[model samples]
Target chain A: MHSSESSEVEVKDVKNAGMPRRELLRYFFAPKAIAVIGASATPGKIGYQILYNLKRRFKGDLFPVNPKQEEILELKCYPSIVDIPEEVDLAVISIPAKFVPEQVRLCGEKGVKAVIVIASGFGETGEEGKKLEEEMLRYALYYNLRIIGPNCHGIYNPRTGVDTPFIPERRMAKPEPGNLVLVSQSGAFLGALGDWVSQERIGVSNLIGIGNKVDVDETDLIDWFKDEEETGIIALYLESVKRGKEFIRVCRETSKKKPIIIFKAGRTESGARAATSHTGSIAGVDAIYDAAFKQSGVIRAESLEHMFDVIRAFQRQPLPKGDRVAIVSNGGGFGVVCADAIELNGLKVARFTEETYEYLRNRFPPHYGITNPIDLTGDGDKDDFKDAMEAVLKDENVDAVILGIIWQGVVLEDEVVEVLAKVVKKYDKPVLGSSPGGEFSSMMSEKFNRLGIPHYPIPERAIKALSAMVSYVRRREEFFRDEE
Target chain B: MSRILTEYEASKLLSEYRIPMIGGSLVNSVEEVARTASAIGYPVVMKVMSPDILHKSDAGCVKVGISDEKEAERAYEELLENARRYKADAKIQGILIQKMAEKGTETIIGVVKDEQFGHVLMFGLGGIFVEVLRDVSFRVTPINRRDALEMINEVKASKILYGARGRSASDVNSIVETLLKLSELVEEHPEIVELDINPFVVYEEGKGGIGLDALIRIE
Candidate 1:
């Protein structure tokens, strides 16, 4: 036993020397072969649904382990992980609480590098469950295996098609492959967010649910995704942070490279109690968390919807060079509303350059408001929007533009989407659209999204999203400048 | 779970960190009070030093504007009597005699140990700004110089420190230095769970500031 222990230590040292700690998570994200420990033949079971989801997307080898079944999902089933012939890089465990630790030990003996436990009733239930979690953790530590959770909904990666969320694809639509990565401490939130992302057509790089974070946690994910070439934004919905100092350190370093937006729940006293029962986490004072986020350059979203809005803005548009924004609207009221929101959200209504003012005055009649909002009047058309956007975008004083499109106007047609999209592509500054109305406006918003412009149902949300981007840029600059 | 140090002990600890304070010495008797007051120069302030009496002013154990030895002696006895009246069995340390700090913009700086994030530093303007409005800013400790500056500038009443309404600008750079020093002090001494330097009077720019009163809690 002593000789084997010494050899294990030596192997661990060699592994550590060969790769950084973050690289260990690669097996979970991009495994060559995977084994489902509790794969079931019956539909609607967690094991079955997880296997079905994996079967649809996972491109690697899949092995099913079920003692009761001869075959499942048209694949051969083994009695145990150790009995499998091929090497398994990852294992998804979905069995009763009593049997999970034994399976974890077996996977450890089988030399699996990573394991995702989908079983509940561990650490969150009672003393007995907590004891089971401890046992599993001991086995994982001895074998040097990385565990995602003792109770979690599992992970999904669009780039590699590694879907392990138990919610079936039909029930929860998987988003297309893109740069936004979503991580949630609550599995149900991820499930709902997945549907929302699909509905909104927000492309995602990965969706991870870290339940009862016994081993892998938000800090590990942030460190791993900070350097990931495919990930451009890291968004999280957290009830509580496990390692506070370490989380701050990793986020401070990562936010300088890319934006990290967090929607931390449990701000009020009643909410803290609910969060405690939900995840068995003590939500510390909310002000301290706010200070930590600010110090680390992490953007804190006010609500769940706000988080998605911020994510869409970061995902689709270039960051503004400054907080000065120019508004273009066909109606006067919408322009006025946007101007009020811009100042309230810590953004300035831009002061146009003389050239821009002269150019707009020459293009439009004297009755038109040709200053900051650049009101194109009720007769505004696609050509008018194109001219206004181009002139303001060309002005050195304007860092961004917010288009308040009242789609109900008679002259404003769907062709405005293509025209504005083409004009925005010519400039590097961010441009967001606000078109508030019924089905027609929603349809136009989707079209705008496809063309790389984030449209909001309300002008306030659009301004809020743009303000989040501006704050992120300001924080990034301040953080880097302090280092210098 | 924690022990609040007497004002004398708290002041000694602050001195170790080089935090600017209205210079004072602990006096054991009426004679010593007069000597310390005269040496530090009047008008001096005297307060009872006792852990049993947390709110010194509330207990009527604090006296200010002592311009002579006779007044210092009289105030010393009065403070001791007040301390005894407030808490008969209170453990008395000594009388703390500090030179009166010149008036400027009043500010507050403090540190509280959060269960999750450890020590967090807090800064705000004093008086109604903090008491009535609760306008303050916080940062996790071991902060950089830039964080210190931001904490000072983040408060709504920060304009008062910057010479708002025809007032001269206070020594903000001095407050930044004290905040950084306090950050280092707490970072090195994790057992110091809580500290407060209330009504830290700031003089005009380039003249510096001094902590007029302080309280320290340790676990």
Candidate 2:
């Protein structure tokens, strides 16, 4: 099984001798002309919604292919891909599973570089579907054509306007273009995540849902995105890895340059059974996955929410030089909670240097706590937070800072948001914010997000995110040191 | 299905990779047991080597603290009798006699073939720490010195190896060397599906360690 699988990849390597894999992937993400096969005119259909989403942002030439329709979404429609006048770089197949292989063969004949198979039945259903997927793969490999999925939501690149997910904008909010690239094996997760990240204002460059993964998988994406100028972090939701050794090798190399966070599902026995049925993937031993991720410098998030929490930090803040964190909060109880969290997460609460101690001592009253996790008292205002933040961030011992800002405090003005934002940007150290409350606290959290600091709902989440960053930095350093 | 290699064969294979083991000799006769026991010095250990008996200690086929030739002969007879009672039709290979390893901090170094990741090396404190608490750390094999050190430090009970209380620090460097050697061994021999060096006796600093007992399973 292993030899045959590698031979297929080698055949593709021979076919595209000069062009690298990353360069070839551009045909999928940045195609100049895209033909949507099985384009529909009716509302609420998969074909129509795919074209609908693409028509909103895709600036390239769009051709809708259908046997019966003359036009779709006011765009000129073609009866077949071969009849299209212009050269097609990508084709999106949205027909049923039984017809997907023939369509893929037609795509190969038309010399389309890549095709996204957005149907659901192939490989995931049972033996018959698996046979259909095998036939589709044969057609793709014959012409050196790359396929994304036999059952997937397809790719979305906000910058290039090449959105292919079938979910319409009315149902799912599109995220703005930024540095994070998310890839998942489950398409529904990508649809729901689009809404979640948009609500939280987390900017993403690309969101790819690779189902069945007959051709493209997480390892290929990681290799491509490692050199992608727009991407600084690569996040994945994987049920199983197709090529475990190759995945580890690529991740180990890419993680030295960019942070890769993964949330591997199927940790328990029943969960593994569910994952196997859901994607037809064998979720091998979870403990081995843990070791491989650590050995490769990949941060494994504990949950789906934790995945984004770590991504938010990686997207906005710089990597801390060490695991020493300093906490500054107005609420004494919140500061104490953060101190415990920092230690529990394998991070040390930084000891402030004597100079920093004297600096805060001269600024605040004796009633205020002025050590690590410095409490500014309930009456502490914006100036007190400003002084505390600046003094700790500038100290050489502190690598990062977590601000436990309580919006419910009486004297703490809203202007403290702007004040703390300015202080955080001036230093190279990472600064995370946590504000736990209802409507007002969320509004303040958004303000902090806009200013380039990730704010969690509670202090524990912030500390956990910060701990992940520290671990990534430490592992990356060790990997490079071993090479030297 | 997998078959377990006799302890003598397993030790020979391990020694070929330069992994330290308490050297032993396999003898078929009772007089040969006494000769080999005296050659290796007193306070030796003797065990019945057989393909059918995987767990020698549990089968009562193992005897320790044989300080004299008379005791060695008696223990050898008892080991053979116990082996027959454990499995009447067991095809006994021979008896193994070696010098008893000096007690130190008990540690375990092992390897198991993962279906996806191939061979993975494991390290942990021995006995209750591994059985009850499952305090162990793992690394995919073909690991380096850095990975070996990390595996040792990752276990929660590693402090015992670092000289907790009044005990002297064990020679962790020796354990690291053993882990690295085992990694290479598995890489060279993929047929080895599972391995265990339980209670690998670790001595004081620079004094090295000994594989007190080992088991290897292969397809």
Candidate 3:
């Protein structure tokens, strides 16, 4: 056991010498060959789903190890991992809980580098199950096997086509290939978020459900995502953090390079009680978590919907240089709402320079107000929004712009999406939009998303998205400055 | 399960850590109280010292503005009577006579052990401001000087400490230094489960601050 542990440490040191930590998590996400320890022949079993999902898009080799079946999914099945002639990079274990320990021992002996345990009823159950989970962890540590979870849905990497989740593709919505990577502690939330991502058309790079986190916790995953080239933005849904100090340190380091948006549940007393039972995590004081998030550069999303909004904004826009926002609206009411939201979110309404003011005053109608919320009267057209945005975005004082298009206006047309998208692309600064109404607004918003423009349904949410960008910019600046 | 320490022991421990405080001493009787009060100064505050009593003022065991020997004697006797009236089983240690701190902004520094986060330091507006507004900021210790200053600046009404409303700015650096020292003290003594320095009077800038009243609990 000592030899195995020392050998593992040496391998890790050699692999990480002068190399980015991204290489540490390479096998888990991009394994060359994976073996399914409990690969089954039946259609309704979890093993079948795991194997089928892997074959659907994964480009790597798949080995199904099943003593009972000769071949499953038309692939030759070995009786066990030890029976395989070649070494395996990763092993997906989906057998019953009682029979998982022996399978893990065999996988370790076979020199499998990584394993994802997808079976349930360990640790989340009573003391006996917890003991079984501990034994499995002991074997994993002694053999130097990096275990993902004892009860999790598994992983999904759209870019690499490594879909290890048990849930079928049809039941869960699979988001398109994008830069955002999601790490969720709950399997149920991970599955649900996948569907939401698909429905919202939000792109994703990877989605991992870190169940129980018996061995691998948020700290390791964050260190990996800190330098992962494919991941542009990282999102996390956590009930509790096992290693608080390490989590904060890694987040403080990772969020400097890319945004790490998080949604933490179990804040209230009852919610904390529920969390402790659900994941066996001691939900510490919520205020401490809040402080930790602020100290680090991690942007905290209040709810799942809020997280999506923030992530979408981050995905579509560049970080604002400052907190000064310029609001452009067709209606005066929307302008007022956005103006209040900007200040309420610790941002300032950009006081345009005299030259930009003169330019906007000449472009809009004579009666249109040319204040911070460059109010284009209700009779404004796509040309009016385009002109106003271009003029406001020209001012060096304005770090971001939140354009509100009240679809109830007569002159507003679907062409507004193209015009706004063009203006947003022209500006290096962040430009967010809000179009709040019925079916027409929803359609336009989707078009806006596809055009690489983030559009919120409400004025407040748009400003909120803009606020998140400005905050990220400041925090990133602080992080970089401190490193120097 | 916390073990309470008398004000004398608490002050001795604090002084060892270089936490500034007004000169005073614990006296066993009214005669000793008079002698200590005269030695410290004319205007001295006296309180009944007892480990059982958490709130000396609330039990009417505190007397301030005692300017003479006669008042000191009468006040010490009254404090003893009040301590007995407040709790019959209370073990009266003696009277603690402290020189009255100069008027300034009242601030509080405290430390409490959290089950998961370990020792957390709390800083806030002290005295009636703390009771009325409940304004406080907390950070996990052992914090550096920058973190200590950040804690001082985190309170919503921290402007008052920075000379707001025509008031002179208090000695903020002194408060930060005291916080750093207290953090070190807690780090050195693991048995100190909780500590509070309430009404830590902050004089004008350049003048030092003093921990007017303190209570330490051990486990």
Error of 3 at A355 (Å): 1.4
DockQ metric for all predictions: 0.34, 0.32, 0.23
When summed lDDT is taken over every stretch of 10 residues in candidate 2 chain A, the lowest stretch is A274-283
Q: Model 1 segments beyond 4 Å from truth?
A: A1-20, A270-284
Interface RMSD of 1: 9.2
List model 2 lDDT by residue over B1-219, tens digit each. 667787788899999999998869899998687778888999999999998987788899999888999999999889999999999999999999988888898888888776667777888888888867778888887889999999999999999899999889999999999999999999999998778887688999999999988888887
Instruction: Give the clashing residue pairs of candidate 3, or none.
Output: none
How far off is residue A132 in model 3, in Å?
2.2
Ranking by lDDT: 2, 1, 3
Across A320-428, the per-residue lDDT of candidate 1 in tens digits comes to 9999999998889999999999999999999998888889989998877898787888888899999999999899999999988888868877899999999999999
Q: Give TM per candidate.
A: 0.94, 0.93, 0.90
True contacts kept of 3: 0.04
lDDT of 1: 0.86
**Location of the lowest summed lDDT over 10 successive residues in candidate 1 chain A:** A274-283
Q: Clashes in model 1: which pairs?
A: none
Across A243-346, the per-residue lDDT of candidate 3 in tens digits comes to 66567778878978899899999777441321101011222377667656776678999888889999988988888889899988888888888889899999
Give one digit per residue, the lDDT tens place, for model 3 in B9-123.
7888999989986637888866686678888988889988899887888899899988999999999888888999999999988888988777888888877665555666778
